[model samples]
Target: MIYFSLQTPSIPTLEETQAVVQEVHQDLQQLKPNAILETIRSWTPGLLSFSYRLLYAAIIIIIGNRIAFYLRRFLKRTFDRMGMDLGLSKFLISLANAIAYAIVIFMALEKIGIPSTSIIALLGSATLAIGLSLQESLGNFAGGILILVMRPFGIHDYIVSEGVEGKVLNIGLVYTTLLTVDNRRITIPNGTLSNAVITNVTAQEKRRIDLTIGISYSSDLKKAKAILERIYREDPQILQDEPITVYVDQLADSSVILGSRGWAATEDYWAARWRIIEKTKLEFDDAGIEIPYNQMDVNIFQKTIDK
Candidate 1:
């Protein structure tokens, strides 16, 4: 009997449902203005801080530039007195200045509320990727440092390496510049130069000049040697302390080649060799010694007619 008129609870009408949704929306709208005001109030301090940070960054940049410039100039004068190459000096000073500026910039960013530690950690994590991407550049950088330390060759020194021969014009951060005798400029990577076989032709004060003279088999070997020795002796450019050696070195089908080695000042090596060559020829002509050439003897006669 109690359940006889139990009605199924009626679902709300569409109108009622819509009215509830409208009420909820109005409440949200009323809260939005205050939320917006609170948001702006919170951002005010941040905006003011941002402005100060910008000003500080500008100051840091200006001061950093001046400090970098001053350090570079000071290092330049010091390096010049130490006989450092101009190229090397510039690289070192610029590197120091760059590091100084980088620190200042990072500090300014920190002052602006950026987390410097987090930035550094992120950079450290990415280092391997960066290095892998720039492997050649990193290698060249290391090679430059090695070159500076080893001092294998300096500017204006004539050197041959990696199949290239020239006078070093400049040693840059990544490459070395060379000027060939024909006036061709070559840029060689420092990484390659650091590992290549280097021949410094003018590193020493004295160098040996080698000259070869060929004479006929009938010519007196002893007489030719004597003339060469005398010629080398008379040349003032030849180093007197070092012994000059002249001997029959090779016998070709046509003539006997005399190998002579004489020591001379590095600057005078070519001149001494040329002078000795000319003098040797004159002495041979005067002494009636024949400088032989290749000639073939033929006996062709009646056999050709018979054919």
Candidate 2:
């Protein structure tokens, strides 16, 4: 007689495997109540641990945010009290706020057991990319800051930069706005303006008017100079300390150049310049001085037909 074994095989046949799985599933379903209790007994402590950590991280973040906010406000107030430029103060405050928040974020992550070194590295890479992409913007920002600190020009100050001559209307973070004499509004990038030669016409309390007049070489230089000097002296608006200079500047191909220079208040610069030009022209006409122009004598070199 053969004896049948009661123990199950470790690797069952296909049908046996399916049947055993179905039976085990049914048994597990029957034990669900006890199984859930056992699972809860095991997971209660871990869940509580996770919850406490999350709560701690949240509290840290809240405190950090508050601290950062207060610090930014304090810095802004201090700068304002010190009479710093409003635009610059606001920019500094924004930058400080961003930095403070970034530090707080990193600290919060670190408190939660996240390795901050990787996060910092990742942020550094991102910052580098952003910086490279915004190089021109960064340059403009730097230029604006330099202008604000150095005070190369001020509002309503006349200046010539990057081929634009106008009165400064506003200095922004990325550009400077100007109102041209012809009433045109122009915007110039601060980076380009900072790099080029800046002629600040209103930096000084007094500015000199530069007037040039061309006269025929045959005209009497002494007479022209005397006439120019008299016009300057007769003008009550001209400053007394600043001498009116009238001298021959150069001998061009067609004419003699007379340079007239006189100092006046910066505000009166344009008025003085216009007045000098008008008066000089009138005086020259009255004195019968010839204002010469460029003349050209062209001789055609032609081949003559052989006779």
lDDT of 1: 0.88
Worst 10 residues of 2 by lDDT: 104-113
- Residue lDDT tens for model 1, 129-237: 8999999988987887788767898878899997899999988778989999899999998999999999998888999988888999899889988988888888999
**Candidate 2 clash pair list:** none
Residue 39 miss distance in model 2 (angstroms): 9.0
- Residue 77 of model 1 has an lDDT of 88
| Alpha carbon lDDT at 172, candidate 2 | 91
Relative to the true structure, how large is the alpha-carbon lDDT of every model?
0.88, 0.87
Clashes of each: 0, 0
lDDT of 2 by residue, 226-279 (tens): 988888887766897888888889989888898888888888877887887888
